[model samples]
Target: MAVMTSQALWDFGRGSGVVALVLLTLSMVLGIATRSGRPAPWLPRFAVAETHRNTSLLATVFLVLHVGLLLFDPYAQLRIFDLVFPFVGNYRPFWQGLGTVALDLMIALVVTSLLRTRIGLRTWRGIHWAAYGLWPIALVHALGTGTDSFSAWFLVLAIVCVAAVLGALGWRLSARFTERRAVAPTMEVRV
Candidate 1:
């Protein structure tokens, strides 16, 4: 097998990062939808939950590839330390640091999820809330450090991801409010 070129690694790294973001967005939207405890138009509730879990796992895999490729690519100038400690890298430290923070959160989420049976639902849920913060940090890191951030296609992809997450969040909130109102006791006054 021919050795991989630096350019190949760079390109692969970028592609993996983009794929991870898309998967992350999908996971986020499905997670929000799952909370409603309702089946999607076509998929059952269990299927939606399974899809959410699978997408999240796939995103994590792509993220690992993205970071691994960048670490090997001399152009990225990323060290293992940079991957763990936030904002210490020589290249675009702040932006890279954001990625580190997101990674840490992802680790926490995955660990907690894996141990959910041992840790119990309340603890797992509290840690899982980090997912809400992870997507945007990863997005900002991509925009700040990504080579294609200004390119038309990347911009469009970013916009669509943002819109999808925001739409899901809005829907979740509205559904919660509607549910609460429906269940609230009404005061009956006869004067």
Candidate 2:
């Protein structure tokens, strides 16, 4: 019987982290699609919102696994404080700090979402917008801290993630513009 090595756990942690990132991106794109209020041929607006919520929850699960594995991995030597404090770790402090910051942002987003009814829509919305910041921070954390950041496959993944969000954002803007145009004629001078 072979025992699991620290390297194996580290690899698993990294893989989970990458998976979480992809899920996060997908969640964001779905969220943007929901805001567009225009459903695709396959998915309705409500389904998009449902997927967004589910994907985010799934991402959170993977993120927990990623962090848990790293904490237990001897090679990582990551302390609990390192996970939240940022820049205090023995290894790759700056890059690790970015990950910590990204995690912090995610925590806030999740907490606020779970309590949105109690928090009030306006307050929840204000905090929820922080998710936009989370994406880039997570991207940079992956690039700076990831072992495969520069690899072709990883680069492709990153490009796809960025493109997905950008495309969704563009679609949303266009939809909003179309809505405004549709309402414009109704507001025209009437005899």
Candidate 3:
């Protein structure tokens, strides 16, 4: 019987991490688009919101798998403590810590979202804001800790993710501005 090395597990962890990140990016993009009430040719706003929710749940699963694989991989040297606490990992502490922070944020968002009704809208929304902060932390963690961080494919993926988020943000801001402008004229003195 041939024995599999931890390297294989490490690779699986990395691949899943990438998938999780991509799914997260897609979820965020769809969420922002849904909020803007912009309907794509193929999908309605409700569909986009549904897709966003589904993608986020999927990302959560993959992220859990990613963390599990890494924690079990001997080469990763990741302790259980490292999963929740930031800046405590023995290897590449800063990068691993960033991942931990992202994980924490993800957990908060998921928990609050799931219990949104019980928690109340204001509280849920407050915690859910952490989801927005998770993206950059996860991105930095991936870039700093992954072996393929400097690879062309990873660079390309990073660019695409960044662009997607920035585009969504721009759209959201522009929509708010347009709404304000429309209301501004209405609010002006009417004789």
Candidate 4:
């Protein structure tokens, strides 16, 4: 691996990108399942929720590897700080900011989630919703930052991935935030 040729390194980078895509898909599925109210039959609610958390963790790992490889690939010329700070990457600042935004949102989601039991329930719920915003920024990062953005195949795949994740989120929101669940009847109307 250390002595690999440029082409080999390039191939490895591309493979990591593919892995990131798959991990993102799995994370989205597990997130939806967790939010859909305790998994039935096969999985206990706790297990499903843990599984979803673990999946998101893996997706974060894949994201690191993906970005690291891209920075090394010569084509991207990305700096390390670009990962954490928005609009710092020289190659494509506006588009790259999308990735930075996603990273920040993901971090916020993970931190709030890990400390959920310690935080106020309402605060935890609000912070956890950052995952929804994270998803789209990530999708846009893939499209705006990738050289393959214009390819017919890439477009179709991006559309499919975005649609699936968002569709599942919609389903989860419907179940978790139903009218009755989200709203409490007031004893008296606000003056």
Candidate 5:
């Protein structure tokens, strides 16, 4: 593990990681908002989509910063390459690889999002759906590699994040089922 300096507390890279956390939270919230149910035909779908893109891009930016700080933090004995490559980091290969996987997913999300307009909607949506997987991998990495991983304060924070994610997912799935049920009756009547 690398040594920590009191003066190193305010490094830009660390700041970036904090910024990333804030962006990720906002992104998750916005994702839930847009995914809850179908908006009216007059609703501004483009705005919701743009907000989603901006939040995702912002989160990606912070992910880069988080990786930068982690490599230099010294406490984790990570290298710059470890940030990009999975499963080959010097310390805690199994857990550290989680971070690498998360990073790669983040990068993939960004790339796919940037090309979303060029790609067809279905293809874009399919690739973007992978963010769900990336989100939990990231949470796991934080629990395993983060400096405050097991701290009481961080524990509460992690719990809240996890709960929010699960609750949102549940709400969305329930809403989908309700919509399907409602439509099924209408279709049967038409038949």
Candidate 6:
């Protein structure tokens, strides 16, 4: 096996981090779509949910790669402690701290998801709400600490992810509101 260089590690780490972000963004959008209870133009509702689950798991895998590669990369100088604790890194502490927080949330989400059957839907769902917090935290971490953050391509990617998420959220909220309104009882007021 060829020995990996510092630059290779950094490049791999950066690449994995970007892939993870894209996957997470896709997962977030699919999750919102799943919650909306609407079938996609092609996929059934269950397929959308399944896709969301798979995307999230894939994102987690890439995230682990990102962290692991960075940990070994001499340039990053990431300690194991930095992985768990927030705002205590040698490089861009605050941004890396947000990453730590996001990692913690992801851990919770993964564990809860794995135990969802045993934990019951209500409890699992409560912990799963942390996902809502996870995406933005991860996004900020990427923008703040990403090596290519200032590049035009990266900025456009970031903008696209933001737009996709916001669009999904808007659709979910509107659907929910419409659903609620449809079921609401009519009140008769006599003056």
Expressed as tens digits, the lDDT of each residue in 1-191 for candidate 1 is 22468889989999999999999999999998887777789998789899999999999999999999999988889999998999999889999999999999999999999999999999999999999999999999999999999999999999999999999988887745332112467899999
lDDT digits (tens) for residues 1-191 of candidate 2? 12467778989999999999999999898877666666657987668778889999999999889989999887777899998799898778998898899899999999999999999999999999998999988989999989999999999999999999898778777744342111334555879
The superposed Cα distance between candidate 5 and the true structure at residue 103, in angstroms, equals 0.7
Order of quality (lDDT): 1, 6, 3, 2, 4, 5
**In candidate 6, residue 180 scores what lDDT?**
19
lDDT by candidate, in order shown = 0.93, 0.87, 0.88, 0.74, 0.70, 0.92
Candidate 4 lDDT at 66 equals 73
Q: Which numbered prediction scores highest in TM-score against the true structure?
A: 1
In Å, residue 187's CA in model 1 sits off its true spot by: 33
lDDT of 1: 0.93
Give the per-residue lDDT digits (tens) of candidate 5, residues 1-191.
Answer: 12345226325554565456656666775676575444425556456646766987888878876676666665557787887778898878877899788778878777877788899789988887777888888778777866667889777877887778777678777745333111343444553
Clash counts for the predictions, in order: 0, 0, 0, 0, 1, 0
Q: How many angstroms is residue 110 displaced in model 3 relative to the true structure, after the best TM-score fit?
A: 0.6
How do the residues 73-121 of candidate 4 rate in per-residue lDDT, one tens digit apiece? 6656677788788987887898888978887887788788789889978
RMSD of each: 6.0, 4.9, 5.4, 6.8, 6.2, 6.2
Per-residue lDDT tens digits for candidate 6, residues 1-191, read: 23468889999999999999999999999988787666789998779899999999999999999999999998889999998899999999999999999999999999999999999999999999999999999999999999999999999999999999999888777744332112467799999
**For candidate 2, which ten residues in a row score worst on lDDT?**
175-184
Better of 1 and 2 by lDDT: 1
lDDT of 2: 0.87
C-alpha lDDT of residue 142 in model 2: 94
TM-score, predicted candidate 4 vs. hidden true structure:
0.75
